[model samples]
Target: MNKLLIVGISGVTNGGKSTLALKLKELWTISSIIHIDELTKPMNKLKYDSILDYHNWDEVETYDWERIKKEVTISSQNLLNSSRQLACLLNFYNLHEHHPILFIEGILLFNSPIDEIFDIRIFFTLDKEECWKRRKERVYEPPEPPGYFEKYCWPLYMFYKSELENKIKVDSSKSSNIPYNINFIKGDKAIDETLLWANKEIYTHLLNY
Candidate 1:
């Protein structure tokens, strides 16, 4: 029997967290994914910032972290109980009884309160220009304010990045709280290239497990 691992995919907005999660699911049939956006507070419930004149959806407080943690914990427990699907990972990876992966992906995952649940964490780093370019390509309801990207999104992302780095530094020194099994991947690579690299990393991790 292999351990049940909760994998966290987190990074800047439009940084391909969800895309990579879906690709991983396609590759590993037995794996399950939980997107953080699905558990966020609705528009009406979100806090509105009068200065920015838009809802502050980019902060850590906007997500119900407790509920998200509970759901991940419960789902992870359930995934561990399934003996039939467990064989699929072993067969696919050519490893005997490899870990069962439960992926939780979202922009704010790294900064959230669920650090204890992650066995492996992958953070995508994107240049600000690339991030803005991708944001422009997508359309959102209640359309982004005139300066949303500049005034709100990017700044918040930087803050979160700094926050995550600080936590990593603390954990590295103390070796107590957050697990040190974190991989940083550049987000500008082609999707196939990123996917291939991620597949290799996951496979290698499983080999050692």
Candidate 2:
């Protein structure tokens, strides 16, 4: 049996990480697909309105850091709870004597403690302007406001990238300049094209190893 894990990372907003993950799911016979966005839904719902209000640093700072930390802590707890649910699902699959390739996709997958779990990591790189533009175009509902990216997500992502680059060997040959990255060919290319490439890579690295 062949087993593999894919972790996708990129800058804060939209860089097509989710799109690529979904595409990979379509291409591969993945036993389990774990998306961190799904895990963070509860936290988003809880802080949605508040986060919307705090679009700028001035507004975010108006609230005490301790209070913000409390909210974040609660959200972190929710993340952990969701992680447990996913873990149970994985364990169930494992116990059945069936080992299937798993693809766990997320923005922060390579950030901090979580990175230790994935066997392979891929980053989607895009310039800040391109990222923000893609995000704005994708927004069906209006986001908090301008400058939200800089005020919130960018700093966290910078910290994550800095730490991640130090931890793993990056494939600099790939166009995506993401910290530790692999470029999975995408776009209007035939599905077979992508699958052929991926299958070859997987067997060469995972099966041979």
Candidate 3:
């Protein structure tokens, strides 16, 4: 297959997008998964003056978009020479597939340039309180201070929601007017069920040659 299949899984922090992406990656061993969180890096480390001196990692600016777009475009297009070069860059020497499935997951992707590249988009959802609880358990380099969640995290998440509210839906499958590429999934579902649903959708696009 010379054509690539690109799947996007996006949602709020602790909304289970990574868990699903990892499961999908493991299911299809040849598949490549690009996680936005892993791609994130702060702009500077020496300029720190106070607790708030560091850039907010939760915000979208921390990610390297130029690198991401280039790699993702190459992966999706499956240009043979580009594929080999990218594999070398990523240090995965064994990857020989010319057209591999690409799964990209991130916290905020709706309004970004990265959002427009996916062939299929899946957005996970969970209750705000549940998300907050899970987010608290996760660690950050510049640790989130007291009132940070209330002031920064929650507010930014809400802003994200506001941008996507009119554009996306909670249950796109139930409505015929919804776009075929956009899918909504509830993160509270059983892991097996979620994986089953995800695998079904992914495999449908991968008609066995």
Candidate 4:
């Protein structure tokens, strides 16, 4: 039987992780695509509402990191219950028994223990300025306060970067004109271009294995 091909797509927030995941899902109909952000959205919404009373960053800073981390972890784990749902649905279809591919896309996917679960890992890179600009434009709740990106997400991403090996990193800030040799697709390109690149790379990797 073919073993599962677990591809992890990860990057800093607003680095196009979700867009790339959606493109890959479109490209690979046979593979299952899981987006952790969708699962975590409800928790984020609740937190956003609850924090509205806090005037600004300084006020929010009154909360300690240790307590914040514990709260966030619990919320995140609750959100991950969706993963269990997917696993059950897959088993219902006997997906793993038949050895179908699986792709999980999220930020911090390579953070510690979860890093070991994937067979292939891809990171999307973008300039910090570009990321900030995109985050500001998001239609949801509102933009994070200035410095939040640097203080929070970037440090975690850098930590994950140091630990990742056998990973493909794609520069998402580049225009579509430039050609990349890797199978990992960047969000800056057209869907067709991304699909072409992804299909070629995925097939090549499968063949090699």
Candidate 5:
């Protein structure tokens, strides 16, 4: 089977991870997408936290990383096999070219087990103020409680942001041992620009491959 590249999109809430994933899917017709939200534990299973006084869905602990890893592994194999079959069928008709890239997008992909699964990772970020502004404009099924973003969500994201920065610093110091390839994207920029940046990274990796 040919190599299949896995790309991860993650970052702060309401920071446009989903939008970028959708756009990339449109651009890469054969690519498959796996959203982390689909792999989250059910709401009933999420106990309310004493600190937040609410079910904290923003943290890494809320997600099932084991399940995520399993699903990704399965999906990767499926996409690769499907691509091989498609290539054979297309070649029979005198056509060529099949690039099967898998996009795994989520809010907390930087966490353990999940982070190691990605060949390329893209993080979208915006200032807290901007994030709040855009978040307020959208609606969620499990409505956000009052002070949720200010009291819990934003703080948690900031914590993760700090951790990511520190990881990047450490990785930079060890040129030969970088564990990840994360591209930090400014979420406030134009969508087209962001798409171009992501495309460039993916294409560059494909070329190197």
Candidate 6:
């Protein structure tokens, strides 16, 4: 069945998921994008000098997952899928008439129950050093105090990233891989070149439509 496509854009704080979502919205007039950060419950602002040597950045409790799922369901045309729906993505649909494309973006988009609903998953990453430097240039509302990146953000990102890599280790023994619409985007790469590659990937997926 032709269906609404849910796109997941995920990455650590300041990893450029928001920018990409905005651009994708611009590219597809029929698309809608949601930022989970906007729906997160307010928390005490981070302190400039507070140092936590270790923190579990993969904690799903940090986000309001229930509300996110509700909002996505309300906004989407959500066609019913079979109970035996494939556990893995077979492909993606880039466009459809009755069903609008939805892009859900957040730091832990993949960690929530909502993740399994996405037809496409895009991960954005930059070098650890680059992410640290960029954190200083970016500002969070309610305003994080100085040195927050050095104290918490950068370290947690790198740590969780390493863990994720270990979990997704490729199986060289398999003759064919399960089809999954996952893409890794390098933020430090040239924007023009990166967008071109992304466009091509989406275009290829659209061919299936």
Q: Against the unseen true structure, what C-alpha lDDT does each candidate score?
A: 0.79, 0.48, 0.70, 0.53, 0.81, 0.64
Please tell me which predicted candidate would have the highest lDDT against the true structure: 5
TM-scores of all predicted structures:
0.86, 0.56, 0.74, 0.56, 0.90, 0.73
For model 2, state the Cα shift of residue 132 in Å: 1.3
Model 5, residue 83: distance off in Å is 1.2
What residue pairs are clashing in model 4?
none
Q: Write the per-residue lDDT of candidate 2 for residues 1-209, one digit (tens) a residue.
A: 22334333333446555655566555543344555544433223333435556422212222233443344345445444544555576654322123234555556655534445445555655556766676677653334576567766666556666655655454454556334544433323454564466455545445433
Position 188, candidate 4: lDDT: 53
Give the winner by TM-score: 2 or 5. 5
Model 4, 1-209: lDDT tens digits are: 24456677776666666666677766553455665644432232333323333122211222333443454355445434544556576654333223345677766665534556566666676666776677678754444555555655566555555544333234344555532222233445564665566556667667656
**lDDT (Cα, 0-100) at 147 in candidate 1:** 82
Model 1 has how many clashing residue pairs? 0
Question: Model 4 segments beyond 4 Å from truth?
Answer: 38-99, 140-143, 162-194
lDDT for each residue of candidate 1 in 1-209, tens digit (9 for 90 to 100): 45766778998889889999999878874578998888887778888868767897788888888788788878877776663455653454334334567899988776777866676789998999999999998887777777888877899999988887887787778745435656888888888998898888778777766
Per lDDT, what order, best first? 5, 1, 3, 6, 4, 2
Candidate 5: residue 163 Cα off by (Å): 0.5
Scored against the true structure, residue 124 in model 6 reaches a CA lDDT of 84
Estimate candidate 1's RMSD in Å.
3.2
Alpha-carbon shift of residue 67 in model 5 (angstroms): 1.6
Worst 10 residues of 6 by lDDT: 79-88
| lDDT by residue for model 6 (66-130), tens | 88888898766433242113212534433333235688888767656676797777888887787
lDDT of 3 at 38: 68
TM-score of 6: 0.73
- Model 4 CA RMSD to the hidden true structure, in angstroms: 10.3
